[model samples]
Target: MRRFERIHDIVEPVEGYRRGGYHPVHLHDIYNQRYEIIGKLSHGQFSTVWLAYDRLLQQHVALKTLKADASKNNKELSTLRHLSATNPDHPGKRHVLELLDYFEHDGPNGTHLCLVLPVMVSDGEGMTVNGKSHEATYVRSISKQILLGLDFLHTLSIVHCDLQPANIMVSTEAAAHSETFLQPPEFNPARWLKGMTADESAPNYLIATQRRRGQLDSADWSELSVKIGDLGGGGREGNHRKSVAPTALRVPELIHQNKTWNASIDAWALGCLICELATNEPLFPLGIFGLSAEQIDHEHLSLIGGLLDGDGQINETFVKHLTDRLPPDFGAENIQHLASFLGLMLQQDPLKRMSTVELLKHPFLVGDIEG
Candidate 1:
């Protein structure tokens, strides 16, 4: 373990526990003998992310500093290690995040675990790939890549419990050129004005310009390359009996309080994600007045119930229970195509839901775009 002077000795605690009383790192602070902090990226519930310049490899990277609570840190570290091992050639596996390195840094609170990851572009929210609106073609391409990555993990019996938009990231280059990606001179953000131009008319492109962080002139939604990230909420399949997905993205089985689950829950969340990508809206809007877990489940059930049969229960033949719940103007063929797929994923019963591999071949994914 690496130790440094107590950060609290020199600085006051930040308002959030995620920072864990660590002294603020400046634009050029170096750590682990290689990385130089360039900018603060984001702060999460238990960690903070910074964009850094890697001295050893001569590239840009994202440094995730997490409060060294042994259990959580260990879980994420082990999961990342496993992923890295499974896919040593990261650039080829464009759908998965590559962990370049991890080390411990001492602070007043405790040892903080810092993970060095690829610096990915920021989509609209933390969950999306591009800030601009994607056509159905782009959505389909992105969804296929995500499914391939999920297949890789599920094959190893690993379950990414929190597979939402925030955890997915987009990269400009293919994995082959990752080492020198975003290196100095070549990575000048100011050059964006001279290189590529975005459609000013599009709302998503307008938002991207406003954010101005992680924006790339060469990034095109139609050619978007995405990766799955944030393994903190992930684990080996069947390890956690209770549901772990966030409230809005929670599966019916989780909301129903199912005791046993596998990687299938990720399929449910993927269904929600694909819908959001196509429509640019969350399928189920979250209730503002914080509802209890049960209350949330009740509301979720109501929305899904409209798509089900007599008793609104999931069963082996649940596909037969599907109804015409899609919007009236969505077109009859698309409604049927989507209902057939979402029905398999949103099944109230885990056993009834389609496997991720099977889901990849469904019409909603394989058929021609409707819109």
Candidate 2:
């Protein structure tokens, strides 16, 4: 066990330093004597991601380290390996994040699984410009790329249960240049750990700042591309999952605990993403300040129900609602086609949802509509 003089203001929770929790990673720490840690990228409930430079390849990559406990039953590594090996000729393959390398590292906490991935600059949230949605053309282009990525995953019978905006990553040309990508903040380990007495279990120093990247709005949309990432919640098509997707983006099947939910859940999420891209607001706002789980679920169901009739078709009310939310410059034809396109994917019945193939062929995505 390790103890500090006082808890430092680190980005991740301090309590996560306990046994079977986060590995105490420090700046300049070398893993497998090949990858050197530069800084932290992000952290989640199950893992912490770091920015590392590969010595052999002489390139920067994102190193995701899963917690000791979570690594025991994790299937993400296997799933990613399978994805990397199969279907090299598919056009949609380029839109999916590839797993470059993976290994197990034994740290003070326990054995943890480490994953090597390409460094991404931004996510779907970056697509907005100062809290406003992007141009209609840019939105459509991003939507098409995400759809193609989903197509590739669905073709492999892999279901990315979580497809929210944060998981949709965008890559920039600037990231490929070593001089620009290797920028690290000024950090002094001796200064930060000066008054603390720590064991091997504690990180030499904690990074309080996260790496920031240029916004997608500032990039040239024609050259930039997006990839579907974070497949930790993913599973085979026919598998049963107790939980899937964020509450706001959950489909009827996931909300109702349908054990047989399939790739159609991704289609439903894509519909939500399309609406969010067109308008800065989410279709279902369940992140209220003081709402219970049951209350939020009820509100979400109501919002979804309001958009579909008993036949699972788009209702007149929903058409008006979406039209009102869209940009004022959108023409009546563009709005009509957009609503129709959303109707095919956002259905109550999973079986009735449009497949990736059908969605890719729609006029909304095929450049027929000028949205």
Candidate 3:
């Protein structure tokens, strides 16, 4: 059997955008349909998400336009298609956001994969999730949703290497007119065109307008489904020679030493994702990319000392890869106690890391799941 490679190992982004003019699938003369492209919904390391609308659906959807990386694209599409087929009744993979449609197109940049998904619009920033009875309420819901997804994937023995908020979507459930997205008179095309550029005023300005797409309701979803997007770093069982885990969400043992982990690896990521939602900040709290290992340094057995059975050099495999491996003071200076609760989850040892199975059923999340 081959050994698993330490993941997040790409020293640089792949260069592949030179070839252009990729075209997407258009059903029912979609090119002629009236749709609008809103500003960015979310942007990640390799893709940008756009909030768009369809004149026919009269609803908002998310359009993810990925950069040109053919090798990664083909791999991602395979997983996405599998997930899509499973939840013929659910989008967003039956967890958070609903997956709508998949389209491949050629553009000025290069070949692109456009994913249409449901939109979770917010009156405020950071998933203004509507219900905020308490901080733990948010923490609990977010955690359980993520854990449920992790648990589901574990059954298939697949790990979502990249698990973060920019990759997450809250549920858009029970929306009132005021809560929903509709183009008001103030935002209508007729009035929105008044301030167009002088060049846009040309007779066929619309003919030159950027191609506008529409909202895609693939199968219609109601519950808050949590779906893991971005398979760029994913791999099946065996053939572990390739790298797949994202550094930030990585378990100390897994990322640092090339240790093979099962679904439990995602439990660590689930804890981190919930921490971000609870505090509205990243759990690991990264600096620039180069300084990442230092940011998540898992040294000295300090973080998970009590949890490990053989406390010798816990996370030793993971800590050695970093530029620096000094043990954190773990006091007021090194780590803050924003949610003293999170300390229970971010354990240094993968086995000691908070288990999503136990976590989701915990009192913190159990009540909220009911709520």
Candidate 4:
């Protein structure tokens, strides 16, 4: 009933409230008379995620609603449905985010597709201790879990074209309770825009508040787990996507565009992520200080070349470079083994990158490197 003069800072872009953009959703709004919207989780370029309570299942779930235009040809929805139907018993499946449900909502804008997923504590980067880099053992655990997740998808001939820290998420456990679930904050329904009669294209009110569900800092690392999420850019193996990963995380094969890239791109990203986790810095920190997008790509490719030799193998000097970048607390032997392990995944040639199965068996992941 109350109206606001202007859009709030915390909510999504107001321009997105158009015919083909984000669906206007208010708190307590029920989709298909089932999932009750609780609060805002997050938003992206094409979709907004909301925390919702499923009446049928009586559990909290993340409801991702894609824009009207994005819903027309949604590959992520198709990929999720495919994953849900296949390999229900695989061990690696547990490491991947599960698609609980999906359906369409015809709003004022257009028909939007909503996906229901388990509520995670936070993104994969949350594994860091109190906003700092994680210990070597913790990083190893997170890396191993992510590898298992990739193994699950790759085994099914699926390629997560955009594997990064943000796509990897920490899973929630029943024992690790938090106020996010117990105390769902109630907000005053957003008012219609000032001086405007009920706009059919926009929601009557926008939920201006955002809330994160869980706390990872206090969680027991021994019991906590991570899952790979955000399959929007994913596709079947050998689909030949045109460089989907972030510039700094892009692999040489993707940058060169010489061959058909595949799931191995995820492996390459895992290698970069390992370095970031070990040192709290991106291995390829490009696009800084007024660098253009083209310049960033060029710099990234150059950095990759510097890490390899004429034979396309990781050069000895690069190994030392990795050692120097890694934390000294990792110990000399552990750093050496980690450097060797990363070398297997960070190959300039996609064919040379290690498969998740092989990576899972590596000495670093198999507990050879002491914590």
Error of 2 at 302 (Å): 1.5
The models' CA-based lDDT, in order, is 0.62, 0.78, 0.45, 0.76
What are the per-residue Cα lDDT tens digits for candidate 2 across 1-371?
22444455556665577679889888788998899987777777788888889999999898999889989968888888889999999988889889999889998899999999988776775454346535556666788899999999999999998898878888776764343533465442423345565567656555653545444556766777789988888998888774458788888876776667778888999999888877777888776569887778788888888777657666788789777877776766777778888888888888899999999998877755554
**Backbone collision count in every prediction?**
3, 0, 16, 1
Instruction: Report the number of the highest-lDDT candidate.
Output: 2
Ranking by TM-score: 2, 4, 1, 3
Better candidate number, 2 or 3, judged by lDDT = 2
Clashes of 3: 16
Error of 1 at 160 (Å): 0.4
**Candidate 4 on 165-247: residue-level lDDT in tens?**
77887855863233253345444444555686667676665654354433565666677778888888888887775757888
Better of 3 and 4 by TM-score: 4
- TM-score winner: 2
Instruction: Estimate the overall C-alpha local distance difference test score of candidate 3.
Output: 0.45
- Clash pairs for candidate 1: 91-175, 127-165, 127-166
Error at 19, model 4, angstroms:
0.8
Arrange candidates by lDDT, descending.
Answer: 2, 4, 1, 3
Where in model 2 is the C-alpha error above 4 Å?
Answer: 1-10, 176-198, 288-290, 330-332, 369-371
Candidate 4 achieves a global lDDT of 0.76
